[model samples]
Target: MAQLRSVPSRSGRGRTLLAATGLVLVAAFAQAPSTALAAGGPVPAAPAADGPQLSYVVNAVPGAVETRAVARAVRAAGGSVVVAYERIGVTVAHSGAPGFAEAMRAVPGVQSAGATRTAPLRASGTTDIGRPQKVDLKQALGQARQVERARGGTAAGGEPLEPLQWDISAIRADRAAKVDDGSRRVTVAVIDTGVDDTHPDLKANFSARQSASCVGGRADTSPGAWRPWDPASDYHGTHVAGTIAAARNGVGVAGVAPGVKVAALKVSEPGTSMFYAESVVCAFVFAADHGVAVTNNSYYVDPWLFNCRGDAGQRAILDAVGRAARYAERRGVVNVAAAGNSAMDLAAPKLKDTSSPDDSTPVSRTVDPATCWDVPTQLPGTVTVAATGAKGLRSYYSNYGLGRIDVAAPGGDSTQVPDLPAKNGNVLSTMPGGEYAYLAGTSMATPHVAGVVALLRSAHPGASPQEIQWLLKLEADNPGCPASDATCTGTRHVNSHYGYGLVDALDAVRR
Candidate 1:
């Protein structure tokens, strides 16, 4: 999901390896104590029993009357407002009061309210910032030379320096780039860890004004704040950004939509490496307001693995995040999210989750798929994506569901049946510090779809979100189940494993 490094090893047969990182705690009230309407009137009375510092999301009816009433109730319930997304009627708050969640739910205008995590604020936990494995310089260079030679010494107009990125050719993005390298006016926001705008391939197409950091449930628009504080510790976002819009400047690697502008809306917390609901809501709202045409979300919202609507806490999270995503879609932004790395079928009758409340002790629980959701992938109005390997088969770690996934793209499988690239089956892209490395997961695949969306947007500047989505499905190459492949289910028109089939950039661009 958000952290691909936490995905289960291919050899583990779907058993996930938990990331060492813990969830972020609500350090303090996001705003100063004041009788301000936006800050939720005044701080409420402290609870009798002190408990772990917890964050809560309160969804209110979208309007001044309801918002003001909800804010007053939040303050009276001993919760301090972290940030209020007025557009979507979602407010994030933190409290140490034991019954704060229940108290907020009792508010007159509050739609839903619940604690965001099971861990205390500032809880003790280790950080697992995923690092890219160091590639041998000699081997990497040799591969590049070999690819160049095969292509007859660069295929015309400025090809990427690293020519062995088969993932680009797998989707025929290289051919699409030759025809139309997308339009710089169409911007795609990478709403993940953070992007390295300074990378030579990314710097030219980076959208500084549209980029921002939404780490603490609020948007920080300061220049360069959108980048990861520790680039090496968190390289996922940069890599994702590179795949979407790493400029075609004869540099590291070619992107799916190399001519488009890319914006970094950092939502992952640097310390804990967790992406909480508050930060995700903020990122969506920021992108919606900033004219972002598309957003690539490669991670699930933390600390819950599957937010069930039956539970008050999980319901509130789903409402807040879902509302934010819906708002973005209403504003002409097409949101794309990873279907997740767990191989479990999301459409199954029951599934066991052992990764919830990841900041603290996680317990294994059997959950009903209908109620519990892995959002915003499962959320309405968002495009859910599944992952395929180099051989055009489902990635071992990619999650699939009959009706859950909307499309499939190359995420790379190091253990594919017939590995195209012997050294690395994973997709290669520009890493932080002007380097390159291979990474695999649905996280890598989501950007390919987002980049294709960028191309569609560039070609049909007047197209609406619905029209673009229609084209995405219609233009894809429909490859039904491979003989004897258990992962493939449903009819040829639309199926669980491949969705509408592989996303075709060349076909999309030509259409």
Candidate 2:
């Protein structure tokens, strides 16, 4: 199974409520409609610090003059600018000085400034145990031959399609294939660790020119730069890319939109397994600028499970990532994100977060949803996807919340009614080094939705991102919660666990 790293638990007190209250006061003071001060004042010098290097995101009031002023403020605060997303008025920076965020916050035209993480640069104590179990190549080849014989040896691309890919069939992708095989014009950018575009299943559809590495806030667009820096860390992104747009060449397995294009936007660092704000910010802008119609984000912006806007540090992250996403949407990209694997109610009033500040020694703290956000997923216009088992039930580990989840897809649940074919229940897709594997997580569920969006874009070439989103919710299969299930929340048509309902590739393509 594609196991997810469990968050280590630690004990601490709640200061979120107090911090949120303080944020209100700051906002009131900043927005109090004060008279303008006289111009030509001396610019404040950047503050110096005596600490280890840390990453920070600074949000400035939109415009050329305001952005330039904030960029100056970043330098004054002893931070070096890494990238300035001029369109969104957000700048990513690195700092080694103490009180860098506080000093930048005091600058004129700077809306928010905060450290991107609580840990020092390159800190390495956290570990991820989740690894993909490789499938036997000989056995897989034998199964492929058997599937070919069953199809009368006339399957497209000569090789037999993966017969055990029930996850694909469950969403009616095969049925959709009979009508439309997707278009090459549409591209789905996999914004995750990194994709192994050399995998035979992905090579045909992979767009090397559009791919890039955004591991450190800046993008490297050289050929093959978007591939995994370490082959060992390539499993997650390769698997996600396969699910979304693996080629139709009768090789390993087929993708949901096999005819569409796939691009790799490497955002995770080589050793940390963390997707920082700067890298993610670079990814959004890159995708939008490259004509990507959709993006699949299987992981959340790391270091904080919830970035509460009430806190200056967390608010900076929210502003930076939020602006990047909105910019992508404006440029015609639909962003799809996993709701998360924590199984907690995202709509809950108060929840305890013990995995925060994940780059450092994490301490538990209570957070309120109104001020805190599970970014990218909770960001405006994102299609937040929940996971479902083969039995069409919510995946046990999927986080759910009424009005929070936008749609559901087959993510596979190994514990479900075990009679289905490939009873392992985890979603199966291509892995690194020309292998295939079974993994389960809301992470597996997200690409299914992204693929369907690609199908919609392919069918309705002129449709806007908003139009495609509306069509997805309108055509979804409404599998309301079981009448006796207490864990399920909300009404039948639209519920917390199965938002809208299971995403249907056939319905999307037909529309």
Candidate 3:
């Protein structure tokens, strides 16, 4: 079965927590009007010293003077400043000190402070990471050969797997490429586990200059810093990159916007594959500073399935990431994130979140939709995406809501099979070690939209992020809510399952 987008319903302590859904990097966000802690409140209970050392982000007032003062306050509050991002006013710190977050928040110039994860730093790698189903190219190749014979024989010279890429045709990406394959100036950052630029399809268009490793909340621009930390299971970024811009070299599958370049932002924890606030914050700032046009976030911030507003710590995580995303948008970068794989209605009256504090024990709780949100995804100015199958229907595992999903695209489905040459329902793309695989999820669907967004960027280089997003929504081709399912609301043009509608790459270029 196709894996759902980030974080499959929280599993037992030792199972594969996030295969494709490790898009599970999801950061549950609560959309409250205010995240302010009680002013002049008494000190809260101290955290256990021996528990687990965690990373934290102390929001500062973005300036040299304010950041310096905040850094000193961090140390005084029993936290060590990891890196102070003056431009965005985010100071990353580490602390095992009891009441570190509460102490930091009390300091002047600190907007918010929260632990990045429930697990101790780097302790996440202890969990087993699962790999995706590999593509059966041998059988696929043989079948393509038979099709060639039916058309009079002996076809050659194309990505061997292109025959199975019904996804390209599904969104008219194939047709768009003929008119305009995209521009080399445009770059989309795959902010996920890590991207294998060494793959033949990706190397040609990989942008190393703008890539970095923000794993520990600090930006590391060392050589190949953007490459996967866990090659065994870090195939997610490479597959996603392939879908956005795998290059049309005819050696492998072509991407949605093949001429555009793709960059890597390795934010996943080395061993655990966890995505936390600090790393995510670093990615947005780095992308903004490095001139990234679009960022595809397939994962969510880990440790919490939903960061409720009532909780000061989760609120801080949401605030820090939201600041970074808005900053990137201000700097001309468009941010796109997955809508999650939980299959819950994000805009429902209330939600049952059972996977919170995922690094430790999970507790189930009912949350009001008016407050809790899917961070970065539900965060303001971020384009939230939903998954569709080969049949253009919402993927069974995709999360949806009347106002949550901004658009939909083929994320692939085992049951919604397409009738094209390739009979498989899963998405096909490049993998690490010069291989390819078939995976699915809103994680998979996100890149298809990112690719089209890149095309819009290439076509209208002078347009702002907001302008591009407007065009993206205006050009969508909505597939009305399923007749059998009453959950999908809104009109044919804008509905919960598809938002504005299925993305149209052809319109992105020609319109």
Of the candidates shown, which would achieve the greatest TM-score relative to the real structure? 1
Please report how far candidate 2 places residue 167 from its true position, in Å. Answer: 0.4
Question: In model 2, which regions exceed 4 Å deviation?
Answer: 1-49, 123-130, 143-161, 417-422
RMSD after CA superposition, every candidate: 3.5, 7.4, 6.6
For each candidate, the alpha-carbon lDDT, in order, equals 0.76, 0.73, 0.75
The best-first sequence of candidates by lDDT reads 1, 3, 2
Over 91-178, each residue of candidate 3 has an lDDT whose tens digit, in order, gives 7777778888999888888878888776564334323222366766677677656666665763334456666787787888888888
TM-score of each: 0.91, 0.88, 0.89
Total backbone collisions for each predicted model: 2, 4, 17
Residue 10 of model 3, lDDT score: 36
Q: Which regions of candidate 3 are displaced past 4 Å?
A: 1-51, 122-131, 147-158, 420-422
Ordered from best to worst TM-score, the candidate numbers read 1, 3, 2
